[model samples]
Target: MGIGQSGSKFAISDLGFVSGGSKRRDLGLNQLILAEIGPIKGDIRRPVSCALIRLLQDPDVAVRLASCRSLCFLIGDCNVSEEDFNEFLPTCWSACFRLMEELQEFDSKVQILNLISVSMEHAGEKIVPFAKHLTDFFQKMWEESTGESLLQIQLLAALRNFVGSLGYQSPICYDMVLPILQKGIDINNPDELNLLEDSVLLWEATLAHAPSLVPQLLDFFPYLVAIMERSFDHLQVAISIIEDYIIFAGAEFLNRHASSLAKLLDGIIGNVSDKGLLSTLPIIDVLVQVLKF
Candidate 1:
């Protein structure tokens, strides 16, 4: 009997054979059908998770990608309990990183990232313990790439989701994450707004979680100021970051930097035409709030 048929009992090891040959199409079909059957409960959940974990390492890229989708369905769509996912989390995590390292295809890496995003959503802060490992993975990826590639942009999005999941108290916070954010700011492409937006959101989340990082961000003050000269989208994010920094760092840090900030804002304001002023009012409000501190 086929694996998806009612009352059929198949060994998890059999999945290896099915995932190997031309029969792989059948395996994919089975996984989708099983996913649609609702959650795999009681006696079967562990073995099914283990089988999917093994399939994630399948030599066929298609199988690996399908396995990732199936895993998302099982974990997120099916509402698998956190405790159940924990049983196979290490194995699944290892497989994800391994695929990230070994896979040459961009789409495959994106599949892995999607799996991670969904997993983090379902697992919540329970996924925080793996933050360092993910940070190291992304750090390596960042060092190797030019940081403007589509893959890198997608990676930034994934990093934002990961950091947002872990919040500020995560062990990977300052040292590991700051460098990546710096690289993100280095990408000055007007077309890559998503990357910039995600980077800014991550920065805001970081400050919200640990306001102590505000001083560290002061080093980037000039860069953020420079960003205000970019397009409106870029300027908006820069203003948001500056507002967060002022609010979190308190009056003392602002006082120390006030002179330089005032000088920068003067130059920026002097350059703004009447039309620009209309759009820049929100930023001006933020500056007013900062000055009051």
Candidate 2:
């Protein structure tokens, strides 16, 4: 009933946590602290929140990432019932806006991704104005295509995650995502690593929030099938990504295009080597689940 009792109960669970892994435990505790603190939106804890706010700029990437995640969670919870939404939402908006912009010049996709994820997780509705700018940023970068800039690709991936992770769907995000989906089908140039990843994320976004878009995406279904024919070059990762999208698209999408998916699955099944086949087991399992729906 007390915090001590809660801590003790969690400590016993640590064995299971350790079996699951240490990182999960660390993040779980961090999230717990965040959820407990609520936001400084109503308490007039300006000094304290301001101090915590500075952590967003910490030199250590991990600390900054954690701070971003915490800030987003705090703001998104809307715990500041007594405070004006304008006051608190601005704080969430400013921090996320700066991070998304600064991430363009910096490295570390995971941090950028986390920052965006948390930002959307919280004040997504408030930040709608910036979605078009975010879309422009990604479009220019993808078009540049000078080299396989890992940082840029990862940043795009993070942006895709951020856009989709928003609590509600935004037309701005849908507009941004649709282009990436079309890009993935450009068989002549399919920047499989960059463009395809973005498309898959878009697929997930549509499945979760806008199932109506699946009909439009069916045009690209064959290209998705073609990519699976290789089934080795990041094939496992690719399959895993596609599986989520397929599931998100749901029964209607699957039912309408069952043959297309079955054909793609057929290609994947044929190419699975004894070693490679195991990686695909999850993919196959997910496809079967989608078919059932």
Candidate 3:
């Protein structure tokens, strides 16, 4: 640890040297230096931290992405006590947020998300304090993502990780995820099966984390039922979601929306002859179970 009394200061000043070159190689080399120097404890690491944070916003995509990975390594490699890690948390998260906000490329976005996953893995409970900020950032990103299927998949995966890391009780658990799922269902096109599938998987993962959100599924019942009518594949996912809702929130929640639920079930039952009983029977069983309560 050559990170002496003035070592961080030297690192900060040396950042200017790294800033002079515009080539990706130069910026990547700078990131290498940062990863090697790593994060240290005490007030001395502040300037080095700030310098790395600034690198996260570099115009070059390589530099920005490399900076993200470097930060991950820095955090993971650092031998700091819990208290010191807590102090470093803000700087680390702020850089992540900045990188997330600024990066436009899908690959770069995925890399930043992976960096966040690594941070969460290393930091454990220390990552909890930034949960709201991370959730808000992800919500914004999800809203802004147009129809990029790959990006949506990555975003959904990232959101799942976020929810899993933060736990079911996290403020972002239900409320924030519900709207995003609704948006997916609203925009879903039959032709874009990948997007639809990702949306369904995301929904399933979110519900797995906070089953209480099952009641919110009532809001999308009509649309899902309509989707179910069009395609058996859609029907499978739609009914599967209903099944989860029944299992999690119990039949009481479905009973509250009994009329609507009945109609939806009726539609599926009515279509079974054309769509085949084999595909629709499981849904019928789940509905029958719900009706019993």
lDDT of 1 at 237: 52
lDDT of 3 by residue, 1-293 (tens): 44433534444334443345445444644555565754455764444444456666676656767777666655666653445445666776677777677767778888787777666655665567787777777777777876777787777776666766666554454567777667666545642565666677666656666636544665665666555656656666666677667666666656666676677777766666665556656766876776686
Rank list by TM-score: 1, 3, 2
- By lDDT, the candidates rank as 1, 3, 2
Model 1 CA deviation exceeding 4 Å by range:
1-30, 33-48, 59-61, 171-173, 187-195, 259-293
lDDT of 2 at 253: 60
Q: Write the per-residue lDDT of candidate 2 for residues 1-293, one digit (tens) a residue.
A: 21124334444244222233344444554455465543233333332234335555555446556666665555445352323333444454455555554454444434545545555544445556566665665565455434654554565565555556443554446565666556654545636655555555555454455434445555556666666664445465556556655665667666666787677666666766777767767766876776674
Overall local distance difference test of candidate 1: 0.66
| TM-score head-to-head 1 vs 2, winner | 1
What TM-score would candidate 1 get against the native?
0.73
Provide the RMSD of all predictions against the true structure, rounded to 1 decimal. Answer: 5.3, 11.1, 7.6
* Candidate that would win on TM-score: 1
Candidate 2 off by > 4 Å: 1-46, 51-105, 108-114, 122-148, 167-171, 184-190, 193-202, 232-259, 273-293
Encode model 1's per-residue lDDT on 117-234: one tens digit a residue. 7777667677777777767777777676564478777777777767667766543556777877765565565534546666766666666666265456767666565565564455
